[model samples]
Target: MHVTWGRNIGTTVQSEEDLYFSANSENWFDMSSLGAFDTYTSDNDWVSVEKMVPPVETDDMITTRDVSKLCEDISSLYLNEKFSDVILVLDGEKLHAHKAILARCEYLEALINDGSQHLQQSEIAITDVSPEAFKKLLKFIYTVSTITITSNVGLIVEVLELARQYCFKDLENATIQTLKSALNLKNICSTLNIANLYDLSDLKQACHTFVDQNALEIVTGDGFTDLSQKSVIQLLERDTLLVPEIEIFKSVSKCKLNDDDDNLVIGSVRLSWLTVEDIVSTVWPSKLVEDEKLLGAIVEIVEVKAKTSVCRAKKCMKNNHNWRKIDL
Candidate 1:
């Protein structure tokens, strides 16, 4: 005979002949007369135990795979998505993988945030600059994105730093172009400071050239007094590449003289070698015309004054006396 139990729960038992029979109504079990059937220790218990082991182990393995896969997919997505957005046109193209790009962005952001924190902690409001402009900074970092400077002076400076950080050749060249174009007498001092800080030799040369070209104008302007002592000395020490034209010297002479009062004395004027001819022509135009002895004395005095750096020329000496005889 066969004995069945818990048909609704899919548990059953079979026996050819039962010496004794006992089974749970809710669960089924087969037993010999020698031992009692225990419903709690049957196939259902084994099934539950087996189920628990696999899920725990399976979950762990799945978690490991998902983490690794996530990392790879995210990296690939960034490379594929962000690379196409680089718009700067240059001779060489820079391509970056997603992982590296993200890392660079994070680093730059940290730098900016750290700088901001320093400014805030120091209570230096004026030094508080926005990192907003650095949005494109990261693209230049990992991918060495091509940079085109149309007009923004500040952006040019920023890009130069970015190039230096990433060792981007083409981006650095673009920055140099912008620096060259933006230089002028008014800003040359600031440009020089920036170049020195960043160790930009080419930028330093460009600034020097600008200052040299506009030496006279810069020295005479109100802005000259505002320059730092170091900047003034640097300007003075730079080699004069070319002399100023006669017309420029004439202008300088007119600037030194008092328009309303011819008798007024002007003090020492320092002129560069480039502008010496212009100065001589303006002060002694008559010397070029007359080889006469009287005119020679006046020319000699002018030459002496120019040489001594005591550029004051007297309109009229005591009793209308020509001091030319004094060997001045």
Candidate 2:
């Protein structure tokens, strides 16, 4: 998810996967992220949860500016002691809040209505979510605006997890965009894996492209050498790898030599492209036995392959042979 917002106007995005949006004139953005406001109608009235955000479009779509002024007005009342209806004890610090806004958090709303004596007291305490994280959440809830992400790059993943956990779809997308922007050489591999896990398709492709472009570096990088089996398997399956297959073979060999578990991932590699010696040394050493017979057949095919004086050792001049002659 990538969000590019213009000043009080449009938002451009280059999404990698699914973005579910409800279509209607009244509903334009999901308010659940910010106290579950439902939709932003011209009257600022509430609607059913079903009437949520429509697809992110630049033309005729509303920006956060719609209710942004309203949020600022509401925020003014947040810190006023006389106007505050609820108190939040977060990580030992007390903060003023409101029932209407807090109700957006379905879990908190349920707890408040569960007849707990504490709810009757208009006070709630939380120890799990950090104050810093909660503060950012509250800021977004009250501002209906972007939470500064550049300075908080290190915490992007954490914020994303928090948003997803709390069903804050818009916030989750914002955090993902931050994560994508913060991707770097050191974290690219793990980021790629995480993106794949969370289906952040745009970030995943960016990571994949990084791997392809920096194949040699990544293959030799500390964390990448220990890359997970799934990532390794996926990398081996690509035809656009920047390095030669031989180099990949060496890299994978080094990886398996370090951990036998990597041997399983190596099974998926197309061994037919490897040289006869590589098949014997690397593929044969591993327990990918299924390739043995095929390798033997390939060897036989290469051996019986007609090679004249001019074409003997020069691979550039090698001609195709009827591979069907090789026994399975």
lDDT of each: 0.44, 0.60
The TM-score of predicted model 1 comes to: 0.36
Error of 2 at 306 (Å): 14
lDDT score for residue 87 of model 1? 24
Cα shift from native, residue 136, model 1 (Å): 2.8
Quote each prediction's TM-score.
Answer: 0.36, 0.59
The C-alpha stretches of model 2 lying farther than 4 A from their native spots are 1-68, 75-82, 150-154, 199-203, 253-261, 276-328
lDDT by residue (tens digit), candidate 1, 137-196 = 544554444555444666767766765665556667766777777776666666676776
What are the per-model numbers of colliding residue pairs?
Answer: 2, 1
lDDT of 2 at 151: 47
Per-residue lDDT value at 134 in model 2: 74
Instruction: Point to the candidate with the largest TM-score.
Output: 2
Q: Among all windows of ten consecutive residues in candidate 1, which has the lowest summed lDDT?
A: 46-55
How would you encode candidate 2's per-residue C-alpha lDDT over 210-295 as one tens digit per residue? 77656667866776666666678777776555454545656676663334565565665445555566556665675544655656
